[model samples]
Target: LVASGIDTNPWCDEAKKQKKGDNKSRKDVPTDAATAAPSIKSHSDFAEDTATEDSDATKESLASSFGKIVLWMGVVAVLAALHVYMSTPLTRGQVVPPGAWLSYCGLLPFDPECENAYLNVNFEGKVIAYNSNRDVAWEMQGDVCAAQVGSCVRGLELRDNGLIFVGGKRIRSIRVPDKSVSITPWPFAEKPHLKISRK
Candidate 1:
């Protein structure tokens, strides 16, 4: 056996086993995978998720903004239509202005053809009232005309809630519209004679 150059030591098998165990231990010490924690995600995957969320949020914001804009536009359009309608002469009753409804309108002989009918009263008087506290009480002076005559109305001395003495005639069931008469003693200070109230 010595001439063949083969040495048979009894501890040689034990040494080989120990070397294998060391190799196994080294292999058990895990690779670089220890740096990758379980909770960690790749940058590309996180960016994709973030981009998707942003896209959804942007879409929602744009939709909400667009909806608000449309709503306001509709409101503005309606208001514009109403303003135009109110400003046009259609609601003016041809000769009467806005903010008043009258009973009748009469024209004087030399009055302009297109004058505000509610502005051309032909009677004159003053309005006085009693407030119970009595100190000469409530008083207003303005001219008034009757709707009895379509051509002209007579003037007279008058008091509010009192009497109308025109040509010594007793006036009954008389109604006056606002802004359509002059309760002063003037030739043109009369009330309009239009059928504003439904009879």
Candidate 2:
């Protein structure tokens, strides 16, 4: 076909050139795919960042709740301390003056089986022997007279040193108000009682 010097086979050479161009385009497809791999990796990194943010938010909420609990506990502790401090009596020493009658009754009033006693103080600030209720007139005795003989007896004597004697026994402490006297007796007594009557 070359010896004839004719252009009848010219379309065959153009077809070969087109086929080479197509092969080059096919080889470029793999390079494009390789370059896109970094974008997929970036998407995974973005997802991890979102998860970290959510975890930080959860930690913050938990910390806030813990702080509130600690604050409330501190407030409760302070209130309890204040309540104890306020309920305690402040005054001390022998405050009951003479002529102040002291009485004690066990459990109930005027019960025959209960321990009931009374102290009658004369107008001269001296203890005197009187009736059971300390209402009847009685002879004045400089010595303290006890209503009952046992440890639960009701008797009061003001000593010279501003101390008190109950049933001829010294008391540890005494609290006296306008119309009542509170005394801490010896170990044998069940509990202290206060009922002051001014005759």
Candidate 3:
């Protein structure tokens, strides 16, 4: 009872159910056009999230500039150790006077082998004496032969009959000889026996 060839067609079952519904609507129309649109990510995940937010904002701006350069290097090492502790120098306190210090300095030639002299004083009131070979030297500045001599410098003597200079309460004389220094009344001159000659 075959109709001569074989076309059991009911429209070929309705065109095989319309080609299986067009292959299930072409696989659900590309999954519904890839779930209908938006998702876009891959350029390496948006360049790795913009390089991890610019490496966490460059590590928080290099930890805020290394904490302000370690707090300005501890304030410049405490101002260079307080400027080397106030420019150093005044070595441990001072107070001097011992028979006005240099007792007999250079020439006391009334006798005593009559050797050249040598002496020196310190503690601010400088005085120096040298001879023998030091080309005869003498320097005076303060404690003029002490005796509580203060008032800025009130005492000095070198007498065989010459050079005496007391301060504050006055007492001066000068008559250096043997050819070296002389100041006959020329101590505080205004013509008080004014005369000074040295070579």
- Among the numbered candidates, top TM-score falls to 1
TM-score of 2: 0.30
- Among all candidates shown, the one with the greatest lDDT: 2
Q: After superposition, how far is residue 105 of candidate 3 from its true place, in Å?
A: 36
Q: After superposition, how far is residue 159 of candidate 2 from its true place, in Å?
A: 18
Worst 10 residues of 1 by lDDT: 89-98
Residue pairs in candidate 3 whose N, alpha carbon or C atoms collide under 3 angstroms: 144-155
lDDT of 3 by residue, 1-199 (tens): 2568766778779999999999988877655656788788889999999999999999999999999999899887886554333222112122223233222222243456644343444544444444445443544454333456444443333322333222322233223233642221212112232133232
Stretch of 10 with least lDDT, candidate 3: 182-191
Per-residue lDDT of model 1, residues 1-199, tens digit only: 6579877565688899999999999987767675544557789999999999999999999999999999999998986665443333211112221122221112222344522222222333432322113222222234344567554324332333344443234344333333333322221133323222212
- Among all windows of ten consecutive residues in candidate 2, which has the lowest summed lDDT? 181-190
Candidate 1: clashing residue pairs, number: 20
Better of 1 and 2 by TM-score: 1
Quality of model 3 by C-alpha lDDT = 0.45
Q: Which model, 2 or 3, shows the larger lDDT?
A: 2
What are the candidates' C-alpha RMSDs? 15.9, 16.6, 18.2
What does candidate 2's lDDT look like per residue over 1-199, in tens digits? 6678867567888898899999998877766667746655577798999999999999999999999999999998886665433222213233333455444442234677644444444444345432345443222233343556554323454444544455455554332332232232411132323333333
- CA-lDDT, candidates in order: 0.42, 0.48, 0.45
Residue-level lDDT for 56 in candidate 1: 100
